[model samples]
Target: MALNNNRYSCPYICPSTHMQGEETKQQETAKIAVKPENILSAPYVPGNVRPRSPKVYPPGAPPKYLPQPTESTSGDILWMSPVGPWAAGHIDWSPQAGITGVRPVVDKYSITRYSTGEWRKNNQFTLTPRATDKAKALEAETQKDVANTFSNLDKKLNHSNEMLNDRIKELSYWKKQVQSTLNGITEELAAIEADRQRLKGACKILMLPEAISRECLELRTGRYEPDLVRDDAEQELIKEVAIVGEIRKIFNDTLIKAELQIEMIKSTKAAIERDWSDKEISLKIDNLNYTLTPDSNLILAHPGVTRWPENATTLEYWKHYCAESIRNCEDVRKMSAKLRADLMTSITKGGEDMKNQANRTNSALAETIDATEQMCEKLEDNLKDNLQKIADIENLIDYLKESLRNVQERNKCVMTRLHNRNYERPSVENCRDEAQYALMAEAKFIKESSESLQSKLREAESVRSELMKYRGELEKDIACKRKSLNIDKDRCARVRAHMPTPEEFAAG
Candidate 1:
């Protein structure tokens, strides 16, 4: 009825459009507001409609999975990945040898300080061929080269030995020839030696016993060397023979004349023997003095012995006889000695050369042995290094193996987690519903809490205003009290100043 009554009274207002000014006022005056009897009551819904229950989960149901807030998974590892990471490994077996090894010498060998199985990590190490591998690779070439070198050394040694052996034989042959030539040229000396030997045999026993020989020499003379006793013994025996000759006389004239003649001949022979011995001794002495090649050649040219001319008288060759007999004798003795010395030097030269050759060969052999032994030691040390390297490599292998196992275990763990993520993810609709329900509950809680907080905030503002007023009043009161206290303090100061000390009061 009100709407009927107001319908004509109100100006036309566009129901879909907003009104302003007179139309807005007229619309307001003509408005038909339909309000229910109770503002909080529900509308008369049909009996067929059911009331909505509060959002609550069914009892004992699996909890909905709270969705992980999706990060920018397009570039992130929000989800577990099935793929395993690529792992790398390395081993350091290269030699880091210190000042450590064996050093062999002729009499003794020494070893440097040694350390073993010292392992360390390095990023710079790269793969290289093992020693055995490298050695195997070069085995044939090294063997061939070594064989060639050894063959050369052996050939040189063999050649040297052969030359040395042949040279020894040649020197022996030359020595024999030289000895034969010496014996042949020394005929006069040999004759003198024969006479001395004959006289020695006739005077005493053919060979004097060493004790008797020593007595005849060392006891009678100062000290006769056994080696030179033959000369001394001969002199003693000759004197003994002379004593016998003087004591023992023959009665027959013819026998006596023969005995005297025999004595004259023996004396003459003794004189000749004496002269020969002097010459021989002088020759021996001179033999030691010649040193130069020219001197030797001179000795060879002049055999140093010139026999006197048998038919020449001193009157026919006076100057030659007088000068040459004495001078030439001296010259002959010197020359003979020089010639013997030269012969001896020449004879031994070949032997000395052979000896030098042998010495050189031995030296080379020794050097080669030393070098070979050194190489052997080096090879052995290499082997030891290789052993250490292999042991360290084994440790490295174990380390890598452990690392690989760890990586595999980690991968398995990750893959297991990934598999669980794939299999165990909750339904998206259930999750979303649960989330929305939770959000609605949260929103209601926030609204209630916000209203409560706002009320509390208003109360706090009133309390703050009251506290500020009280604070202002307290500040004014404190200022008044401060001023009164200052006045009291001034009056107390005046009273204290007027009051005197006890001594001043007494004096006054």
Candidate 2:
């Protein structure tokens, strides 16, 4: 019988038909084969061989055995036979085995099949459909986070823009205020310059050197001269000459008038004495004749008639009688007494009238003297006051002259300065023209500057308005962006809840 290598084998030995007739011989061969080396050399040993363990075999089945094959002498079978289904059924598969030939074919087929089965199992149990959905969800959350961050950045940019606009507005407003203030200062400066020019003109008009000179001359020449003394002296001389001549003429006239009156009275007294003397002599002669005649006739004397001497003249008798009568004269005494009384009365009355006239003259003279004295006193007082005033005025004039000299010196300096400035005499007309031109230029400059300032102020105001408008728009944009950012933040919060946590990523 031919043996098939696929057939299973047991651990028991059986006698071969070919080996039965040779059994006695085989027994001796077996006994010799039983030796240690011989047994080790046997392809299969009998009882000394260890069978395949039951753990590797099925229960109640024979253990499979494999023989070590020898090399064929002929080159007919070059490739080795594979360990078959027994090994396939009993041994665990190792991916490390480099299978070849039929074993490789079987191994590849089994490995393909197992891999397909494992892939199907993993698809079912290890990796679920929810994983793809989770990936998509995570991608969406990342997109949302990106969008929210971008939106927040946009809002920040908008807020920065708004703040810049506000700053620009404030700057523009301040620029306008500064421009206005500058314009006001410029106008004030112009007004001050105009006032200064006016004051300069007024000073020029009022305090001119020529006017001061004329005034000084008038004061010095006209006001404080001693006019009263010369005038009074001239008047007094005229009056004294006239009054003294009049007084001398009156004295001479009065002396002549008194002399004529005294001479007339004396002539009249001489005539009266001469007439009395002539009458007394004729009366004595008549008396002598009458005594002679009467005494002779009376010789035969009556007893009652007184006796006279024979040589007694009538004149002597009469003379004696007259002398006796004159001695006892009461009539002449009463007449004399009456005349003396009249003369005394006339003289006393006349003297009293004269005395009253003299007294009035004296009083008039006293009044004149007092008036003259008072006038002199007043004049002296006036002269003294005038002299003091003149002295003061002279001092003032001296000071003024010194001042004028100083002023002249200063003017000379000024003139020298002007000359240096001009290099020649500057004509009044030319100076006036230059001044007017300068004033016109200044006025024009002021006007133009004012206009420029106004224009600048207007421009500043316009810029301020534009800046304010920009600020307002920026504020609105900031508000809108902020609102959008707030909405994005809310959406980002919602997205964050489903996304992977930072701690989960770390763990993963």
Candidate 3:
């Protein structure tokens, strides 16, 4: 076969083929027959340009170009890198291509050691399968554990959610109960407060009747002399003042009780309201907890939050506490109702009593005024009759005086006639005569008549003086009665008219 001179040539040809003559032929045959370890250098070639063959070809098979190597080595080509895509960019490997009987460089030694270590590690026959199987089993176990963990988390979350829902429901129930109690207590407090106000109003109203009673008593003090005596009207007025005072005291006491009761009711209401407020907040908190989820943005890590409170109450204690609060509210409500009822009773009775006493006082005043007016009228009539008797006595005394004067003149004329007769008839006339005897008897009779007339005049004048003194007393007494009537009937009665009605007192 002819050798072609090309630098890019097949590296399968031996270098001894370049010799001439029989020696050349002999070298060629020797080279061809060379053992694997005795082969020399070969040239580099690319994998795609020159495909490799597994076995060597004998001489005279085909003509081909071959590369002349610049150097040679004495070694068999134990192995060559196969030409393929994997061998691209690698140093072309041919027969007898490696270093021959020389120590490798440090980098080559390092590469060889590294490659040997990799091979040895890959060829761990005993440990690889077992270890691989264990790793695979671990992977499977990890996957299963993860799946189980997820499942458990889901179950636990569901359970916790259900518990939160139940808790929320419980809170809601208690909230409703607390709210009801709060409402009841609130209403009771309002009623008690209103009753207290009414009591205050009633007390204020009582002042009017009390003032009237006191005023009436004061007016009675203005009565004159005999009228100032404690008559039925005066006695009734005094009693009215006492009664009004007593009623006022009772109202004040009732008002104090009402105020105290109102405060108690208000306190109870406040407690119930506080309980209700707590329940409302708890309900909201529980509802929020029930609504929460692991994915919720509101969720956060609260360390140690799951711990139970040391002061937490048990179910029985909780129920008892709730029930006790409601019971307390109910008790307070009942108390408020009873208090209001009692207040109502007090108002009614007090009002009626006040009105009745006022009426009695008014009636007594009216009767006393009528009696005074009648007494005044009778006194005036007696004064008129006494005056008429005084005038008739004065006329009778004048007539007695005139008659006594005429008798005196007649006695004087008789005496003068007797004296003239005695002087004119001397001793004969002085002798015991019928004219002298008649004159003497006439004088004696005149003297006795004058004395009797004078006695009658003195008796008449004494009687007239007594009657005039009695008339003056009567007139004075009548004036006093009139004054008393004016004070009682006119002034005090007008003040009594201002008394509040029973309905007004009750309303108060």
Identify the superior model by TM-score, candidate 1 or candidate 3.
3
Q: Candidate 2's residue-wise lDDT over 154-208, tens digit each?
A: 7876676566555455434434443443343344334333333332332232223
lDDT of 1 by residue, 189-256 (tens): 44333333333332232112222223332332332222123342245434433433332221122223
TM-score of 1: 0.19
Best by TM-score: 3
What TM-score does candidate 3 get on C-alpha atoms?
Answer: 0.54
lDDT of each prediction vs. the true structure?
A: 0.37, 0.39, 0.71
Give lDDT for model 3. Answer: 0.71
Candidates ranked, most accurate by TM-score first = 3, 2, 1
Q: Which ten residues in a row have the lowest lDDT in candidate 3?
A: 67-76
The global Cα lDDT (0 to 1) of model 2 is 0.39
Error of 3 at 127 (Å): 45
Between 2 and 3, whose lDDT is larger?
Answer: 3
Residue range 20-131, candidate 3, lDDT tens digits: 2543444355455543432223344434243344545465542222212211221122222333322212233222132222222223224221122123333443334445
Which prediction has the highest lDDT against the true structure?
A: 3
Clash counts for the predictions, in order: 1, 4, 2
lDDT of 2 at 132: 83
Against the true structure, candidate 1 has what lDDT?
Answer: 0.37
Ranking by lDDT: 3, 2, 1
